[model samples]
Target: MRGAILPADSDQAVLAGRLDLGEGPTPVLIRGGMVEDVSAAAPTVSDLLERDDPAAVRGRPLFAAAELADRGPLLAPVDLQAIKACGVTFAVSAIERVIEEAARGDMDAAAAVRGRLEARVGAGIRSVVPGTPEAASLKAALVEDGMWSQYLEVAIGPDAEVFTKTAVLASVGWGAEIGVRSDSGWNNPEPEIVLVTNSKGRIAGAALGNDVNLRDFEGRSALLLGKAKDNNASCAIGPFIRLFDDGFTMDDVRAAELDLVIEGPEGYRLDGHSSMVQISRDPEELVRQARSEHHYPDGFALFLGTLFAPVQDRDEPGRGFTHKVGDVVTISTPKLGTLVNRVTTSDRAPAWTFGIGALMRNLAERGLLDIGGGAGDGHD
Candidate 1:
């Protein structure tokens, strides 16, 4: 059975319904098109999954998906403490990274990046069990590199990096400015499958997400990826969660198809599609890695990486890159509904100041600086 988590028509309260998809699986209850307020009987989406057993919470009331008032959907699926993003999980991504870096006229750096990608690809085939020959060889090579590394990817935490609103606002107060871009300031939008987990880091459901990134920031320093990605309104997820039970497995999820499309005022800017099977690592592996060092007490959401993102070949001179204001991007799947957002630029841009005091004052003038280092400073 399929459904949607929605905001109540009368008030702004969030709600869910078991959709009437006609002749598929039988839902818990059938009250017209959806099971309105699935939370009435089951509080959270996690609770709904926990009680999904036929013998457990059978005979509950159900409703329809069409009963609600017409309102654009919210992008965020559930309350989350952090949003983690995995990168280079696809071969296409590796190719794109190397090419883009080369375009910046850094052949040596690009070659080193390529070597690391090769190492990662090879390592994935080797067993990393300690004491094994492969493990020892891999460890020695890493040590010999003497701090050299690549953009294997990262998971950006801190609530400030996540956004649900349709428009992405870059702020001047927190160092987000228009003129601060490195290359053309042209940013690209990536469509990916998002996994929603509970406090214990257990997978509960799936959803759509866009991991917005600034190419210019990444082009400058590979180490500055966190800065390139973990900014305000950089991460987006939702439309709603698609739940799964103990019976569901990663293979089952991987079998599903995910697609993305970006449209501007002129027409379609970018389009692509891919499956989880193309990813280098499993979603479970990524989630486990993300939680290895940090604690997400309020639970977390993860962007399982992306596939088939548009790449700028050296031959193609004028490939349109970067998203602009008024651009609309969507990621959709039959299992999880489409997540759409409009691109909007912030009114302010970053400026060069002599000291931290001036920088603080600039933030204060825009009512962006947080007092006592609280929410005022959304720094990661």
Candidate 2:
């Protein structure tokens, strides 16, 4: 993990090439390390935001810590596509890659990959613990974990940033947050993940919602953290994933302003703008520290947050937008000035359907409670 020592003063910003381990976005902005933002200015990434029309608000709501710090408040409306336009190269190294291997069903190989990703995200590559066959199998299924469109519920709230990073995280566009999932039909309900957002097109805070996810629908069994991880944390929730280190505490997150709202037509809406009130685990630290604690199974809890903004149908098209996923469901919006979200395929069959609030109630019945904004096993 030998990196160039960047004093607290020198200033420059640009993306890195190849797999700059111990040097990519995660470490550069490590809760403890002063950022060495070598990334270029916004112009490069902004120019590629496909839909630049003054009217299109549909684009990706993405920006690393450096990008957020450099850019002004993320209060403007943006769609998913526009956000993903900024293509930067960050390799999936060591333990990160290892986990992907395990998630793919290769226990032995996955154990190897775990050794690597865990090392990279954690303190060092040399300390990764071996993965068990069971852990590896779980990883395999976990890798293919796609957000369910027909089975999701919305915990309408003021903040939850990850919703904004749909494309990057769950590989889907938005969620059943507002009811209309990317592949939902009137008959079937979509309760992929419980989400929260602001009515305006901004996410400067973390949106919290517990998991009502069911492993076997109808309150039979609850989806554990592994099953719900992809559903829950699929992106970076910020303009506010603060860098905390020695002496820093939840009090700082409490001080940060997180604007959230839910607006569409005139009458139906919900909004809550909260100052984070508290944030204790700095993700960067958790990830890195995991490297140190890899030996202990489930010993470390890693969280990756982001703002959520899905494509919704509102008078004409709402400026807010998202990158559609499914091949069957197509949504129209006036915010981005066009059909901002939709399924790309020609399939029209109602393969899956979901309901509102039912998913949450069912999960609770099965012992799956939304532990804050994440899933629960009743542990810490």
Candidate 3:
């Protein structure tokens, strides 16, 4: 998994991430195939990214990057960063969300609704830009035809759908288990590119993410979004964050193509693809919307919503896709490498005991808090 998780051009890539060194979460950098503990320069990933040149920060070498998996489990490459996500940022995802609402969380009924809805509005939604006069006209027409949906409103409406996905220190990293609600009958994984931003909302780096979805809960009522989204071990991010450099820039993120593969314990396999080029809202636009009337003092990780929405029947015809326990889900892109995790019920997944308080106490105990006090400030 370690070999698979590194970028294709890792030797030239500027990477930042975190690892469990038994004492606590330690910020590290993977450069030239070596893992260097950067805690001496910056105590947390959040602090490291606050540097003008986070990739340039040096540290003590711990081990070769090849032994990453054996050294210790990789923690989410973030500390104290808020976890936020955008919804229905792709035409296909918007349509699938409408189907989810129409079916009222019933996977068996989705096929018929999907067919009818796609036939009526798919092309129109795909062509219109959000928050435009053209989008307004489309909304009017859909409402007149008695087909208007809240999901559609957010999809093409003036404001994008940005919501909090989980909390700080709640996200799991590579080779960990991702959770889905046990009772959720309709669900799937959302493969996305997560933008790591600093306190001032500056884009520091990018990483792969799995925004695990519980369609049943959210489809029943959008108000249940919190319950549907925030669950124990439901969010998975990392392997490592590729800090922006001349070698990789926002243009690379704009043209990224993500691939997802789910291997079920019962011999079921599903392959899916999502292209950033197909996204309705540009990554920058989404970030602008997120920063509106908000402040992330510890910075934030924003999930640029996915385009892939699984409609293929897994068990029975017309039943649609849903995760089963022990399914290994892999989300990958060449530049960002890969993020892999096993699926399990929220109740069954390991509890999230380490929170901000635990983190602060641990860092204090290790004398990390004073090592790099305000090291990365007034830079970039």
TM-score: model 2 vs. ground truth? 0.25
lDDT of 2 by residue, 55-125 (tens): 12222223333333233212111111112110000112222222432334222233454444444334421
Q: Estimate each model's TM-score.
A: 0.60, 0.25, 0.97
lDDT of 3 by residue, 1-380 (tens): 33488899999987899998878899999999999999977889999988888988999999988787675557999888999999999999999999889989788788999999999999999999999999999999999999999999999999999999999999999999899998888889999999999888899989999999999888888889998999999999998999999999999999999999999999999999999999999999999899888778788999999999998889999898999999999999999998999999999999999999999999898887874345334533
Name model 1 segments beyond 4 Å from true: 1-32, 38-63, 67-69, 102-149, 152-184, 246-248, 312-320, 346-380
| Segments of candidate 2 deviating more than 4 angstroms | 1-220, 224-234, 245-250, 254-259, 265-267, 273-301, 304-380
Report lDDT per candidate. Answer: 0.49, 0.23, 0.91
- Give a tens-digit lDDT track for model 1, residues 212-317: 7666556666666766675545556655555554444466568757777767666746777868776656677777777765655545667776776554422224
lDDT winner, 1 or 3:
3
Q: Number of backbone collisions per candidate, in order?
A: 11, 78, 1
Tell me the alpha-carbon RMSD of every candidate. 11.7, 22.3, 2.0
Query: Which stretches of candidate 3 lie above 4 Å from their native place?
Result: 1-3, 371-380
Error of 1 at 145 (Å): 12
Candidate 3 residue 76 C-alpha distance from true site, Å:
0.5
